[model samples]
Target: MKLHFLGTCAGTEPMLDRKHASVAVECDKKLYWFDAGEGCSYTGHNMGLDLLDVKNIIISHTHMDHIGGLGNLLWNIRKLTQMRSELPHFDGVDVFIPNEDSKDGLLKLLSHTEENFCCDYENRFYGVQDGVLLDDGKVKVTAYHNTHLVRWETDKPLSYSYRIEAEGKSVVYSGDVGLYTDLDPVIGDGCDALLIETGHFGIDIAYDYIKDKNVKRVFFTHNGREIINDREGSLAKVARLFEGRGTICEDTLTVEL
Candidate 1:
């Protein structure tokens, strides 16, 4: 399996060579989208990822920076059907999102786009909750609630982190946690890799949080100013501290797990 980073920028203003927070896990030729930040499908397509093979799209939250390209992603997948004769083996794409309002709004917005957002393949939406969400034979995705969002009217969570187990390896996505410790339960004892988002925090805090943990690998993503503004310095610091156990992920980069 491999991990492809489509966008690595945070919610901040546009920066050089970065878009937003989006990542895709490729397993057995199928794609599992983690987030659909701005231009995610565009970047994935350009990176040689076949959007038709996208079996699932999971969103951490409904924030614009996190879901800005969700509609386009769906639209592009449908558009590709006209250019190709093949359909996914599943013949559909399942989306897991935490916010029902965002899903409704996206569908409404897509209705105004070309072809009235019609597609031969089914695009199903599932509400995210804290539990094992899906086991597709290729991968098992589990969701855990985080303190990224709170609601006074309901007990539903508006943000989540995902624990993905595939090929006997486990990976945890932080998904913009409110605190580093927020991932403790989801991470459990350890994981093969931690795709920790740095959009809301810095590398120092990230390092400090995981320094003594059993995490085998670390990939710093959703870059913030501290790392993006000083790539060389940050890379050097990570290399020195983590000693090859850490990496600073950039857009369009793919890594094997």
Candidate 2:
């Protein structure tokens, strides 16, 4: 499996060498996109990835940094369909989102685009709930809710983490988690790779959490200022502390496992 890191910045102001939070998992010759952060489509296409091969669009939550470029992504997909002689492999895409208002708002936004967002393929959006989300032939994804935003007990959750299993390998994506323990349910005993977000936490916190856990590789995404301000020091620290198991991922870099 391959993981393409399109954007690695958090929900902070503009920064150099970073965009936002987004990544794509390539498995079974298909692409599964997670988060449509700003400029994701631009970066992905430039990286030589066929956007048409994307079969699933999974959003952790509706935060701006996470969904800012969603409309543009759809528009690009439609635009590319006209340029290419053939259509997307899936003929359409399934979008798994958590907030109904956000989904509705995006659809409404798309309607204002050219041709009223018309296309030859179908695009479906579904609300995300805690459970086995998708089990395509090559991958199984499970969602675990987290308390990122304060809400009433009756309100549906607004945040989640994901566990993706493919070809006997497991990956835990920490989607702007409220706390590290928020991923316990999805992570279980261990995961082959932990794509943990550090937008709301630090590397030390991650180190403490995974030091004893069975995480083979750790890639830090949605990074905070500490790492950005001291990348050289952070790299050395991670090398020594994680024993070369941790990496500060960068946008446009694809890692295969």
Candidate 3:
């Protein structure tokens, strides 16, 4: 499988080469989108990715930085199908959002657009929960609530971090956690790759949090003050700390896992 970083910026003003937060896992020619940050689909599609190939869109929270491009993503997919003579190869597109309101709000907004947002493909939405959310033939996605959202209820977890398992390999995505320890359950024993966020925590904090864990590779995304303020300095500091275990992710960067 391959992981594509569409946007790596956080909820800050525009940067040079970063957007917001989004990633896509490619398995069996199907794309599983995680977080639809601003211009995510645009960046991915322009990079030669087929928007129609997207099977699932997962959201960690309802923040604009995370879902800024969601409506555009759906619009672009429908536009692609209309432009082409053929329908989408996949049956439908499924979106998993942290709350029902997020999906409903997006649908309402889209419905107000052209042609009442009519489309040629079936797009389904699901509310995210803490459990196995998707079991595609090639990969299984498990969601565990994190402390990213302030409106989370103790009885019902709406925010999440994801553990993606495919081809005997696993990767954990920390979707803007409130704290690194919030990923303990999702992290579990270990993972081949950990797509962690550095928006809220520093390099040293991240190192300390995962020091005793069994993470093979760490790719930092959803960048924050440290990286945005001083890219070279942050990279150098992270390199000195994790040596070969860490990588500062960039927008539109693709990695094979």
**Candidate 2 residue spans exceeding 4 A from truth:** 88-90
Clashing pairs in 2: none
Best by lDDT: 1
CA lDDT, candidate 3, residue 128: 85
lDDT of candidate 3 over 30-106, digit per residue (tens): 89999999999999999999998899999988888899999999999988887887653557799998878777778
lDDT of candidate model 2 versus the reference: 0.88
Question: Which segments of candidate 3 are over 4 A away from where they belong?
Answer: 150-155
lDDT tens digits by residue: candidate 2, 84-165? 8664444789999888778888888899988898888898889888899999878998988988853467776888889999
Error of 3 at 226 (Å): 0.3
Error of 2 at 58 (Å): 0.3
TM-score of each candidate structure, all chains considered together: 0.97, 0.97, 0.96
Q: In order, what lDDT does every prediction score? A: 0.91, 0.88, 0.90
